[model samples]
Target chain A: MLELKEGVRHPVDFILNGKPARGLAEPRMLLSDFLRQELGCAEIHVGCEHGVCGACTVLIDGIPARSCLTLAVQTAGRTVETVRSLAAEDGALSDLQEAFRRHHALQCGYCTPGILMSAEQFLRERADPSEQEVREMLSGHICRCTGYVGIVEAILETARSRAGAR
Target chain B: MKPKPFTYLRPADINEALQALARIGEDARILAGGQSLLPMMNFRLAQARALIDISRLAPLAYIRKTAGEIEIGAATTQAQLLAWPQLGDATPLLSAALPHVGHFQTRSRGTVCGSIAHSDPASELPLCLATLEGKVVLRSSKGERVLPAAEFQTGMLATARRPDEVVVAVRFPERKQGAGYAFMEMAQRHGDFAICAVAAVVSGKTTRLGVGGVADKPTVREWSGLPNGELDDALNDFAWELGGTDDHHATAAYRRELVRRLGRRAIEEAAKCSS
Candidate 1:
């Protein structure tokens, strides 16, 4: 068993929710585990443990990555954001989150965090991507419950609402 | 589900990375983008005592045009390469094949060098590299050496890279003025590992075809010129040469058919460019 000590001298620094975090973790500690266990962000779930399931998705430097397959230490000096941080300061859902809720994008809700993070990144990069683009971008994520229709509708609605707002 | 514990070293530079690999010896693995290695680790397909994360070596993460070659640092991400305008000119086969590698998310984290190093028979990068006759730069504490793409790949998930060496970069010769390139692959699902992929580069009147996923390593076939009905014959010959065993994704015979169909299409496309 590898012992965990306070600040045991591993250089791992990354910005989380506009705050800088530094820690020392075992080389094998996954970013998902580090975020959940060390950083106490339990919303980042571990679905497949492999990269196939995107339940552990997070934005690394504004691009979505599978946290389960990413080492915690490798995120040093980078920006790591989870869906938990996407909400407003008053605990209100963002426009996309509201759209997901209105569209009923979640049934079991197990895959919601990952899906939300992925959708957030996708919308950020491409505001008005087509349905096919959305489908292609979300292929890396697996959602057994929602069947993806509601999710797709939610993303499209968000895009429309955002376009109208602009 | 968590990976087995291992020592981690994030080298500041390529020299330091090579030194760490030498010190850790066989127990160490170079971490480029963690797209493949990390997943393999979680699946317990690979176990290492030390991981030398090379992502921080920015000098090894670029796409540049040099004298007569297009150079890409080993750490250059697939997404970055796809966005490179010169890639369409220098190696359009790679640009055409990049979108099929995986989803947008995977491409963001997957590096070209890592893909080449992993050398999965079904991967797109290896086929493109081999077809383009790309060169890989490898560095060790002892010295540096360059290996042609043909010599770099040895087998499925294997390469000529020594345990003590780190791949620094790859270079592709500039395409000739009259060269045309085409790439095609079939997968059950988009972004999935290819069932069979073919890349071809035609210059003047000659053509070089490279096929992947049908053999242990990428196979390249060369033709003097576009002979009448020769494209079909070459496809058949390539299929016969592959002779791979059936697996879950596709049967050997089905893959052979794909090779024939896709090969003919790629050649026709290349011919259009020449004309």
Candidate 2:
């Protein structure tokens, strides 16, 4: 049997929210734990350590991923984005964030960050996304409050608004 | 729950990974996407004394097609395969079923072979593999061998692979020309495991029907000749014969009923698409 040795810590250096960050994590440390406990970024919540709950979703190299399932060291040299990155440099809310607020898409707010992250990426990848597409994208995320009516509306409105801007 | 402490080794290539597996033996588990293993570990359902991190094996990340088949490397992510422009044309069944495996997020990190290797009875990829008659390539220090997807997966979370061997790639031989495809699943929620899922590839004279979540492993039953009355009754009766057990998510009887309903719907859906 392979032995578990002591004193193993891998160095992880990466770009987070457009800022450089570094940390040392055991091989088993989850990225969600690294973000919340080590970096003190609490916005990314962990509802189920399993992949079923999308609460721990984040952007790895700009792709939406469940941070709870990813190892901390796996983010090495990659760009990581969280709900915190959705705001503008001047502190203005991004279009999607503003849309969420306008539509009251969130209640309890635990699932909001992950939803916002997933929605933002969904919009970024596809231009002029249909309402059905938006709903399909949100299927990965669960919202206890609002029953996803406002959340889906907000994303659809954001897509329309973004299309007008373009 | 945190996984029991285990040493981690990131091998740069497949040879190194095989060597590490041989050295570590049963104590080590291959860390691919970790979409399944991490959850199992966190829930204390799976424990490993060590992990061979093969995510860095760049050579194993590829999607190539020959004249008659599509080959996907072990390190290929589910999302990557989904996004490939040619995938829908080459393997319509896979393209149709990939989105149902999990959410887009989990799919982003989940590897092709990893999903195939996990062999979850309710998993979409395995059902597609079985329906399409795919092949799984496994390699270890003892050398490499190829097994049909039907032979590769033995049972729920069980496979024919020896502990030392790792599934290296999956090959989907080309489907019959002008085959129609449909994938349908009845999950509690979107992205949830299907209570019962079905995939069908229908040509003018032959139809391959695959069912999941009604048994310990996905089952593929093929029929020759166009859809007939006997097919529906036979399928419903056949579904009852699957090794289903009552669990919290569903009852064995409920699963059988789902198999009957979803199976008919899937066949209809496939029949509609046959060009």
Candidate 3:
């Protein structure tokens, strides 16, 4: 049996939602596994188990990473955010989430969380990205449902609405 | 499939990384981005007895211009390299080739050193590094040694790195002012591995061409100035030089044809950059 939390433990101390927590984990454990199994964040799904599928996406230091491919120990001192943290304490969706709903971006919803996380990072980095840029940036993700028209529309709509508000 | 049971070690610095590697020796594998290693582990293709995680070493992740060369930390991610401004002026070939890597997510974690060490014939980084005559900085408990790109890659999925040595960084000579570069590859999918890839860097009279995915290792050829009717000859030379095998993706004959066609196009494109 493989020890998931034993052996030479690397101390992972990082902030999640303005709170700091530390954990001891094996270096080989993936971040996705750590989040789901250790931290009890089941919202972060393991998709392809490879870097190709973005279903394991999460924000590391505000950048999207395939948590499946990222070692848990690598997140030792970094900030990590999953889809579960996107909403407020009362469960109100953010503007991006609202836009996703309004644009009918999700289908079966299996790929939604990853797409949302990637889009959130994309929007944060590029407040006014072109349609092509959006497509290129989201190419890392794979969605078996809704093709991708809905996701693109959602992101663009959210950007426009936010631009108008600003 | 989870990685086979292995002792995991996280070294805080380069010296520690090297020492851990030395202590673990041949049964160990160094984990960088884990973009490639993890997938291979999932498939059970790689079964390392120990994993040396080098992600914590932050100093080995910068790209800077020094004297007449561009020094890139082995841990530099593809996204970082693509966004690097100096790459556009110092090594445009690498800048052009960066996007062809796996994708944004993989690029975000995949390191240049890791890719080079992986030495996948279909990967873009190895071809670019080989064509540029890049140098790899490898460190061990014994000392440090720099290996040129040509000598660094031994064969398919093989490198010159010793079991105890960790790749520290990669350095490329600054491109000549009038030099031009072009990289081209064909794949069924945009982010998929290339069936055949070509990289060309033309400086003044000498044009260097590196072809990958058609050989055990990246094959490089140089042409002094432009020779009349030499393009076809050079293409034939490269095609003959490449001893590719029939694989699931493409047949040996098909790969040879691609090398010829892509080689001609790359040469033509690179010729335009020659002064």
Candidate 4:
């Protein structure tokens, strides 16, 4: 067993958005704090720290999970993709992000990054999702602004556009 | 909210994990998915001195089928079970209930056995396990013991698990060929904890009903060859027997009423589907 003592920060190395990222964290450190405070990942927001809020959602090994509910040590050798990775290498907004902009899907933008991450993962698995299905996925997130009407429309429109492009 | 400082132990395999648990004793908790445990730790509801990390134990992540039941390992995530090709056909009740366990994000990492280990009254897996009369496998360096659902879950947020033991696996009975199954719940939001949840299993001349979120633990009652009117009376009595307590999410009377109404709906639906 690899034992990490209490109150001592241990080295944690993982892939961040396809790049190697390393940090030192206590065993009690949550992945949310480790990303933002330890590794300078400011794009990951911390809402309800108990996993009720989706502000800390990120893709670990391509599966969406609440970073706040995950321990930093658990991601030692895993790949973690934050919302910041949604943009292209050239820093251009992804199609889903553009769709959110055109449809006015967000305001204040606190929950947008998490929503976009979930939307990207959702759209990747589903080429043509119904409005209700998109809404079901959005239920994971809590966006006080926009009331989800615009968010739903944007996701649906993105599905339509992506289908057309194919 | 941050968790209290705790020692983290990453065991390479199950043997090492059990050894670590045996050594650490009561102050240690087996960290499987950490979806529920981590949340509780963050809220300071549970403060473990050490966490034996078994989430990375490759040998523990499995869903195995036996002659008459499906065995889920400690590290098998909810998403993996939901994505299992045979899940719907083999255990329709689990298929119906898994979606309501949590949102997609949480389910991706939340383990099946971990939920049972958590023993949350509002959780879906425990209710399903109880409705199916599932068995929990508690393992330690000493030995292994299997406990039925009713005995495994002792009280709210509690189980019969010893401090030195880990919930290695849980076995759920496969759906009988002719039995009908149905699960239903009423929650404030799609992914929020259930105000009341019900599961029903109906075979010829017998019906098993399990109720959760209204009691300290998920409880199941069986009725055989009851007519509709008599079944209504029985459900009313069962609802009262549950002693539904008033919480911020709902009132005791409201919960009892749900048991009567939603419980009836679930039973009727299962009855209809029964061959």
Candidate 5:
């Protein structure tokens, strides 16, 4: 919705999904908009647009953040990971994503991408997280569908599986 | 869903940022995290001709404990502070209150001084600062001034900061050992703006209580071990003195009750902290 205007733009170069991606982004353009429109990363869903919804969340420099609230230029020299980065090289699901599928963690799926990114980061930080701990980490994410029951189960299962593998 | 067009300037240094801010004056807004500012801009609630981006100004991203206070640089992200174990020991109230600020995503980019400067009545950071008698450092091309948190936040979404001055950092007066503290809030959801919240520090028999969302600015007061039993009478006399009015989140009458109940609970919990 912002490209129609002639305004100041900045050339952004960053690592997106293990690949170099460069684009000219306006100052007023949000990272969510840049990822969706310019980089063609459509997994970032923008709900409520006000940052309340976790639909547009992404990993900036390996930390989950609301891309809708981050400007495109802010990622000028950083690494960004979208939900698309969760798949294996052969397109098989990551352990976390498989758990999500096995547990039926999503319903409408609009909030799935953001939740997956958030859970992935949480799991990375905490190799063995309790069910309560998982809930607390996920409290920041809002999952309207599934009542957060299946999502919680999925992350817990993944954490258990990872610990068991060790 | 889009912000109005504006020019963006990423100053390489703090002095350069200060100079540009002084030159642009009210026309420019400092971009720190953009959690609140961007959302406001998207809703057309705020507009600026220019935005001075300071999120990456390395000099302003620091947390230092000096003398008896913790100095937090303006660009210090909430996530960074939350990860600091030393801060957890020094300012337990801050660590306890941080998780309630926003979800993990917002906290990842939200800045401490940004939250202080935002000065939302229901925000947990402001409530913690007010309860701790913290100070905010305001800097400009001319000079710098330090203001106590109580004096810095003038009203809802308003502060004592001049247009040319940027909130360089915030200073939290370090608490002594055995000062038990707790933060409690009633939000509609986990990450939503709190309808009413309270921060309390219980040191022996005395207590310091700060209530948010019930006033234009958070209300802080040092009290004796007993509760403020005169709340009903006090409301009649100082309704305007409090921070909140009748808003959509909660009615004034209901908020007053929360202040009474939550304030008591916070003090009780703080007393249980053991240190």
Candidate 6:
């Protein structure tokens, strides 16, 4: 059993994006803060701090979850993927990101990273999804800008293009 | 806002988790999905001197079906239940209501037992449990005991579970032959909390109705046989018995009316399925 005392910083090791990352986190520290502050992962945006907002959404072991609702200590030895993982190796945007750009899927870009992370996993799990299914998945996120029309189009177009490529 | 400082304990197994709970007692809280507990901690609404995280306990993550009941381990996530192939056939009410519990993201990490432990009046899982008359299995260092859903959930945000006991699993009765089930809820947003939720189980002449988000806790009432007018009157009386109160989300009268309307719809649909 691992016991970390309160009011003290403990080392938490995890796989960030794909590389190994370690951060010092107090027992009370949330995974969202630990990723952004301790590990210098600025891509994780903090919105409501509670689980309601999707701004802090990330993939823990390839499953999308709310980082704000997760404790930093809980991610020990687990793989945590942020929006940064969606980009290509040479700084080129992935197909989904490219689709978002073409469809004007984002307005303020605050909720884009979380939405992209969620969409990446959603598409991976379901290669061919109906518009209703896509909307249901997107319901986890709250996008105040773009009215969600562009975001939906971007995801559907990405699914269609990806299917065509396959 | 961050949680208050507290010790973090990751138990190796269920036994270790139970022992720690026995040692820490009321000062400790079991962290199983963290979908609800974390939010309360972040908002400073709840404080724990220690958090025993059972999420990593591989032994506690399972869904077992034996005889006519489905037993969900403490660590089993809601997503796992939804993805189970037998979900639709084993317990159709859970299938219809699980999607409305939370969004895809939250469900991926939220545990069924954790939601029950939280005992939120607006939550769908407890409502389903009440409607199904499920059992909550609690274990401690001393021994184990099981309580019915109605007995386990004392009131909103409260349960009858002792401080030293850990909810190991929950058992829900499987689908009965020739029975039909339906769940319906009214929430402002898709993933938001329900303003009023209803679960109906229609089998033969007996009809069970469980209502949530209208009272302090989910309440279930059964009617054996009643004419259409009598059933409406009975539902109206049940609604009044619940004493629905005005909240920021809805008015008392609006919620009572929903009970009369949605209750009828759910019962009718379930009856259709059974027929």
TM-score of 1: 0.93
Off by over 4 Å in 6: none
Model 4 per-residue lDDT tens digits across residues A91-137: 99988889899989999999887888888888998999998888888
Candidate 1 chain B least-lDDT 10 residues: B266-275
Interface RMSD of 5: 5.4
Return the lDDT, model 6, position B105: 95
lDDT of 3 by residue, A1-166 (tens): 1222335666678976557877766766778888888788778878888777789899898888898887777786789988978899899999999988988888788888888999988887788989988887778888888888989999998888888898
**Model 2 Cα lDDT, one tens digit per residue, B1-275:** 67767787777678888998898788889999999999999888998887887876889999999779899999999999999999888888888899887888888889989988999999999998899888999999888999998899899989998989999999997766777899999988888989999998888878778999888899988878844878767787678779688999999988888877888788888878887
C-alpha positional error of residue B248 in candidate 5 after TM-score superposition, expressed in Å: 2.8
lDDT per residue for candidate 5 within B1-275, as digits (tens), equals 88888888888888988998999899899989888998999998999988888998898999999999999998899989999879778898998888888877888899999888988888999988888999999999999999998789999899999999999999998876888989999998776899888898988767777888887788887756554565444433433456356777788877777776777788779989855
On lDDT, the leading prediction is 6
TM-score of chain A of each: 0.91, 0.94, 0.91, 0.97, 0.93, 0.98
Share of the reference A-B contacts seen in candidate 5: 0.56
- How do the residues B198-219 of candidate 1 rate in per-residue lDDT, one tens digit apiece? 9987777788888899999888
Backbone clashes in model 1, listed as residue pairs = A13-A77
Q: What lDDT score belongs to each candidate, Candidate 1 first?
A: 0.85, 0.87, 0.84, 0.93, 0.85, 0.94
lDDT, ranked from best to worst: 6, 4, 2, 5, 1, 3
What docking grade applies to model 6?
high
User: Which run of 10 residues does model 4 chain B get worst, by summed lDDT?
Assistant: B224-233
Instruction: Put down candidate 1 lDDT per residue, A87-145, tens digits, no spaces.
Output: 89999999888888988888888888988988998887787989998888878888887
In candidate 5, position B92 carries an lDDT of 88
